[model samples]
Target: MTLTLSHIKKTFNGFTALDDVTLTAPQNQTTVILGPSGSGKSTLLRCANLLEKPDSGTLTIDEESIGFPARLSAGQIRKIRALSSMVFQSFNLFPNLSVIDNITLGPVRVNGQSKQEAQDAAKSLLDKVGLADKADAYPLQLSGGQQQRVAIARALAMNPRYLLFDEPTSALDPELEHEVTKVMAALSAEDASLVVVTHNLRFARKTADKIVFLEHGNIRFDGPADAFFDSDDPRIRQFLSIYDD
Candidate 1:
């Protein structure tokens, strides 16, 4: 399994955010976490990378259990985070840095890769994301969609084993949203092992091998995309119905 979460539970200030959520995602398969707002989709992604600590449960990547970093050293948590790269809804890029610098920054700083080596890798990633020409442009100069694509390129620069997306297209206008989605679709097609928490149901349907529904901080449904499309479950049908109307 590429990822396994067992009895995962998280709470904040006496409120339960996630309760006993369990899931297993296969390697090279796109798994989209679907849910309404505040359904713990983003929380799940955050917990997976140790960005948000789970109150209880085990998270395993590639069958190896992850030790909760709150109990471990800071360096240990960074290592785990490095193994998985997250793309957020907001394009989190340095306004002062050029696109190329944004992409190469982390690998150089955290991985301690030489500047020349990081640049070579960043160039290849930029080409993959169709942003090679925008290398010198700062984040503020690019459109929202372009900045998000640069974020993807930056994540890829780390050469992570898994990719996590948290509402990656939520902040874009319709036209710009399409641009980002097209790039994401292409990437998912090339490598299916992507975990995305998104409200884009169409992208979930088209790109995901498995669709897991979360409601009230719990896994309401987990099955193949076809089942989700068919939506035999009452809750799944009701949840999906919102989009139709």
Candidate 2:
């Protein structure tokens, strides 16, 4: 399976955020987008799922174009979005909803599954994410890692072909981050396609199948994980130096 982005460009007012950005994410692998702040990594992820629409680009999944040659209708965009689900940096769980509700709402509301069906799916997903016992708990009741896992489950409830993570562990402490990173590593073992935007070098080194480095909204490096870290490229070395601290 593949998700391809061709010549994507996004602009805000007069500022160009993503300039001719293009890349492909393959099935059952992690493609980590790395860059410093304002480097458009997040913008790239947002464009892939249409959270922020690209001014110009072709988005294709599994070799089929999502919308091409013509602008998409709102319904078409939603249909395309369902093909891949996104998990945010901050756990965007509904505070008023219980864990099971947070996980089941998408399948029930978006996928038209029965409540029981949704609950069953949520149950399986919770087990997968190691949050089965917290099904009845509220968001405030869990740690950041637990909430992020719930977020992952909610994304899975839609049965997406690809999962997008935006700085998945940026908000958590190191210990909590490790917990979530293990879950991410587990997902990769299951051949779950993932696209992540992150700066956590240790996690990226361990989890990424490929690394795509961006600077000033353009991809500067795209290669295997080890090569990216071992390269003598000044930009890559300079950016990585901060982690030495």
lDDT tens readout by residue for model 1, 88-152: 98988999999999988999999999999999999888888888899999999899999999999
> What's the CA error at residue 53 for candidate 1, in Å?
0.3
Best by lDDT: 2
RMSD of each: 1.6, 1.6
List pairs with backbone clashes in candidate 1.
Answer: 28-192, 28-193, 29-192, 29-193
Global Cα lDDT for candidate 1: 0.86
Residue-wise C-alpha lDDT for candidate 2, range 13-84, written one tens digit per residue:
989888998889988899999999998999999888888878888888864585434667888777778989
TM-score, prediction 1: 0.95
C-alpha local distance difference test of each model: 0.86, 0.89
Report the CA-based lDDT of candidate 2 relative to the real structure: 0.89
Candidate 1, 36: how far from true, in Å?
0.9
